[model samples]
Target: MDDIFHFDTLLAGPPDQLLKAQEQERQRIAADLHDALGPLLTLIRLELGRASELVREDDLSDLAVVIGRAHGHVAQAFDELRRTVVNLRPAMLDDLGILPTLGWLVREFERCGSGLRIRTDFAVTEQAVPSHLKITIFRICQEALNNIVRHAQASHAALSLTLTDESLCLAIDDDGCGMPDNSHRGRGPAGGTSSIPQRATSSGGRCDITSGPGLGTRIHVCWPLAGIRP
Candidate 1:
């Protein structure tokens, strides 16, 4: 399998890393928008028609109640927005590493009310995987789940990360309505699938996909850890 896809740093190195960094920065900005501006908006809404004295107040009490309700709605919106930010950049990926991060990601997916049962089989450890590889794997899983949520209307999905003496393998399988044809390469529900090969190739690995009209989609990516350049 390692011999199937030739490793090439030139294909997957600096440019991909730069894109990843930019995405992280975007997540940070999203968090800021949720944390800082969310509260400020709520405060503004509250103050718009706030009432000081309740006694002998002509309709001011009613206005305060309305403003309070508006503030509550703002708070709800802030929470939802914050969740979006977290989904974008998952802080756990940095603090907890890939395996735990994937676990959290799976939990998030389950909470989406999609009835998607994602079974995971991770046999790799944080201490063994390199930092860059960790990020790549996490991004792959993130995009995979997004694809499932958006297009797979399927009920069951599974993910596995296996590590050997010389290489690492990441596989995602979903029992969904597969692609219509090979010509619709980038049109599959797994829009991110098109980039999987590049991500693997850049990291001294290879990506393979198998799917059709009725056959479930399976994505397999393997990268040799032997001569991966920093």
Candidate 2:
């Protein structure tokens, strides 16, 4: 049994090799979308606009109209494509770091007209959190807000990220309709049950969810920053 266990462990290679490969793939795809596809879309839009400009609207009304409609479709496609690229890997997260990216995310959620007012209090500087943990922290917060938008029919929400001597904590609170009685006993919200908590726990962190019928829901996550990275 011990020999078999050693052989299986050997087959697995370094545990981190798989994680490294995944991250590398993510980076490659993100770069291709941002650097290649984004510019190609812009070029197509410009070419269409230029083609339309060449045909005088008075002389070629029908052709111009066709080109204009095509331009509109291209515009919509470009916007959606940009959103997809952002979802895949937000440039703000890479350029601005986690705090600003989070603030931007809140503003975006508020813009959705979900009738949910979001307030943010990010007390920790980006330097305080280790680089490796920032993506996990951001993703957990993102998933939490997504749950609120989808499940919590709330009016007001608060997002706070604070760093203490012991840990870096993120808390999301919503004054929404809250969860069912069984939800408290269950894992989490339907879609987020695994993604949110597993992300925290995998990083040597912990997550807590407090919710009740008509009482709203609060999600708290804390990551002990010390010794998390080599």
Candidate 3:
């Protein structure tokens, strides 16, 4: 028989690492939006208010142009907020399960003005994964796709999930530029491809990445389900 199961031993360090990385990312985004863009937006609003007063007095012919520029800046700020929110946590992933969440991510990426083609080939059995595990898998998928979009410059990508008698395996493949020669395994201060393996290990699993220059990248994560009730 296999060894007895215990959460303390099974999920020792990786989840905590992931949580820390996520928090750091949140802080960075908050500082960028609140600290950097926030003041600029406030100033723009003040200028817009002053321009409005000038327009009411019919004293400034250029007021409309100033207002137009301010409006454009506001639009840009809103766009930045949207990007930051999506990066921090995809709203759909919280609302839906992994499958639908992944679908939503793919759609968002296609609409991201990046023109990358994403294909999915998942075969998960709808078994109820633990909440933490679910979140980890979702994030791993998100990071993998982001890497493909940001670095791979690849035209296509694929994702697959399968469950067997003993374990569950998920594979993400991309036809993009591969990792650099010196790339190492571990989550960076800002979560990236390195975090996937850590996430997998924390879930009593293992993750592997295979890639080379001009070749596609493939990430495989496997979690043992021998003692899991679900």
**lDDT of each prediction vs. the true structure?**
0.71, 0.70, 0.69
Query: Which tens-of-lDDT digit does each residue in 1-230 have in candidate 2?
Result: 11111011122234454366457658866776677567657766776766666674544646666576667767766776777778766898889999999998898898988888999998999888788888887777777788788888888899999989988888888887766664233244322343555556657676776666677777787877674652
Sorted by TM-score, highest first, which candidate order results?
A: 1, 2, 3
- lDDT tens digits by residue: candidate 3, 82-146: 87877766676667767787778788887887888888877774454555677677878887887
Provide the RMSD of all predictions against the true structure, rounded to 1 decimal. Answer: 5.8, 9.4, 6.9
The per-residue C-alpha lDDT of model 3 at residue 69 equals 80
Error of 3 at 17 (Å): 6.4
TM-score of 1: 0.70
Q: How accurate is candidate 1 locally (lDDT)?
A: 0.71
Better of 1 and 3 by TM-score: 1
Clashing pairs in 3: none
Q: Lowest-lDDT window of 10 residues in candidate 1?
A: 1-10
For model 2, which pairs clash? 154-176
Predicted structure 3: lDDT: 0.69
Worst 10-residue lDDT window, candidate 2: 1-10
